[model samples]
Target: MMEFFIQGVLHPLLMPAHLLLLLALGLLVGQQGVGALKPLCAVLLLSVLLACVSTLHWRLRLDLEVALLVCAMVTGVLAVLRLELPRWPLILLGILAGVLVGLDSAAPRIPGLRGHKIHMLLAGTVLSSTLIMLICALLALMLRHLLEGIVIRVLGAWIAAGAILVLALYLLRDRLA
Candidate 1:
């Protein structure tokens, strides 16, 4: 269990793309104000649950890595603009991001956990994904409280810029190869 939990936490932390998405989500939620945070979190969690379960029997052929970069771009732009979008749109964003991350993280086994059942892997991935979102949201909340809305927008711009660079590299990789 400990192993699964740690692996869940570590994988996203170690992956730059995932890290950026998590943080960007946090910043977006943070900018949305405290009243909206809980519902957004709930929506995101539900989305992750559905996505992970869906992955057990199916994997989308969509380029998840590129999708992640795209997520970063969208979320970053939202944050940068400090858009006061309506509730449904924000919920949709969470759902989209949750599905993307869950799909990417739902591999059947971790490096040394070959004997573990697929269900176990899914649980751990869900847990880890939840943690990443929670921590990022919490940090963004703090930053918002301390630094004001402008700072959040700045962070969002940075996130989008980083995503652009990554997306470009991935798109160009085949050509380079």
Candidate 2:
């Protein structure tokens, strides 16, 4: 039980796609300025909860990795550009990102991980993912003042490049195999 919970907590950090999406989304949100933080956070929390519950009940087998990478690429580009987007678009992106993260973070169908144990794992994942997003966003926000946002933009570009490479590799995986 404890082991599963720990695994759940580490899922987002361990998964490359998940971590990239979180970082890109966080930088994007941070670049949106302080005014957008609260609402985006709220939307992210709600969407993540709903997506996780839906995944648990429905067990949707969607190939969310590609979707997640696409999102990361878009967000990374947006961050690199540092566009001053309106509130609605940021909220929409937040919802999309939150849902993707939640869906992808679902516990694997391991034997013996039934009942409350599964719930425990999910709970830990949800908590850790949310906290990591918040922390990364806050870090980006702080760095904006210290470095005149250059560091953020550079990180965004790196993220975009990385996502593109990984996405290409993922798409060609079957061919490679």
Candidate 3:
């Protein structure tokens, strides 16, 4: 914490601090634990500050990043309670999901699938995917106006950015558990 304070708004510490807070908030919701709220609030504050301070493009993309995290946590809980997919199935789902998300993100506008599962549980693959679209759309509309085909750039960046995020999650898993 002191390291982050000293580094001020621009420190690498701030992003992780923010992510950890955001993840903790999800965990608290998952467990229905009330105690985590204080820290979670702190983390969000740090993330906001970091975005203002850091020059990194990813920092500017925090809202989309956090939106994806929230959606993932929601789907994860539902997956645990309902899907019960075996480890292999989970792996396959991960692979296929990566592809779908890539498609969803990269495409200029996502087409409606008449009977996709997103309509069923209302918690299907596309539900979370839609959340990503909504957040990205808002970000794109606000950030640029050049017909940048900007959403595709964001989509690609999010995927690559997600790979890096997995490393952070790995650290969180090891350190926290």
- Order of all candidates by TM-score, from best down to worst? 2, 1, 3
Minimal lDDT window, size 10, model 1: 109-118
* Top lDDT model: 2
Q: How many residue pairs clash in each candidate?
A: 0, 0, 0
- Give the CA lDDT, 0 to 100, for residue 3 in model 2: 78
- Cα miss at 86, model 1 (Å)? 1.3
Instruction: Show the colliding residue pairs in model 2.
Output: none
- lDDT by residue for model 2 over 37-109, one digit each (tens)? 7888788878887887777777777889999999999999999898899999998998998899999877677
Residues 1-177 of candidate 1 have per-residue lDDT tens digits of 566656765777777787788879878887777876898788878888798888767887676898898998999999888778788988888888888888887666346655545556567667676677777777777777566577788889999999999999989999989
Q: CA lDDT, every prediction? A: 0.79, 0.84, 0.33
lDDT of 3 by residue, 1-177 (tens): 333223332222234422322232233222222332233333333333332323222223223433434434433343223322334443333333333232222211236633422222222222333233233334433433334434333333443345346646754876878
- Candidate 3, residue 28: the lDDT equals 23
* Cα misplacement distance, residue 45 of candidate 1 (Å): 1.2
TM-score of each: 0.86, 0.93, 0.23
